[model samples]
Target: MSGIEIIRLPSRFDYSFHRQFGDLYTPLIEGGECDDIILDFSQVEYLDSSALGMMVLLQKKSSVNNIKVKIKGARGATDEILKMANMQKIFEFI
Candidate 1:
């Protein structure tokens, strides 16, 4: 927890995964034990608005806990979506 927690997203990162997404990061953020959280987008093929919202919420939660968040392995359309959403302001790309 003091190091980093990598949450690997799924192929379809949308509303369907909202609950699962929260389950992945909620405890880590709330525990205040982790120093960094890496969202591994390696398997993500698509992400809708809901996914964007989730990311925003996650950032808000982690920031309050002084935890860092980063994104990695985003390519093609997924990367484009993130940029269009101005995710760079909230998440560091690794």
Candidate 2:
């Protein structure tokens, strides 16, 4: 509803960050104070399926709230994994 909310993801993005991730975005989305959400993967080096699943879940929640979600700073194996998962179909990389 106002500006973008940028959430900086942890270096090792996995199921461990699931609850924290949700806590970070849920309030912003529910508050309806932002039109867009940017997930910063700049610090991330490795990620697992659970991380990918978390992203998909975010996308679903964001879409329902009419909020745009984008991923940024993905590189190396992390980037490749995301591409392999066809995450581009669900999230726009920046």
Candidate 3:
């Protein structure tokens, strides 16, 4: 386990997020350089199903690497979406 790596989400988490996050998260996790990945959602106001898919993908990748994934600052609808998706079991939220 290494140090934590944080990624701040955009205002809208969509397909672009998928592409961008993939590029960023892959190396960070697969490189075995981070023990935890914290996704900051403070600036995000909306996240579509694609975003959910991205998160699940993140979870899978992180799990494969034996890394922890946390979600932070998710509020209102964004928080609700995560809860509805049962993400609490998949990620640690703070």
* lDDT of every model, 2 decimals: 0.94, 0.93, 0.90
Q: How many backbone clashes does candidate 3 have?
A: 0
Better of 1 and 3 by lDDT: 1
lDDT, candidate 3, 8-73, per-residue tens: 999999988777989879889878779999999999999998998898989897898899889999
Candidate topping TM-score? 2
TM-score of 3: 0.94
The lDDT of model 1 is 0.94
> Which candidate wins on lDDT?
1
- Estimate the TM-score of every prediction: 0.96, 0.97, 0.94
Clashing residue pairs found in predicted model 1 = none
Task: Give per-residue CA lDDT, model 1, range 1-94, as digits (tens).
Answer: 5779999999999999999999999989888789999999999999999999999999998988899999999999999999999999889999
Could you tell which candidate, 1 or 2, scores higher by lDDT? 1
Rank order (by TM-score, best first): 2, 1, 3
Worst 10 residues of 2 by lDDT: 27-36
State how far residue 9 of model 2 sits from its true place (Å). 0.6
Clashing pairs in 2: 1-34
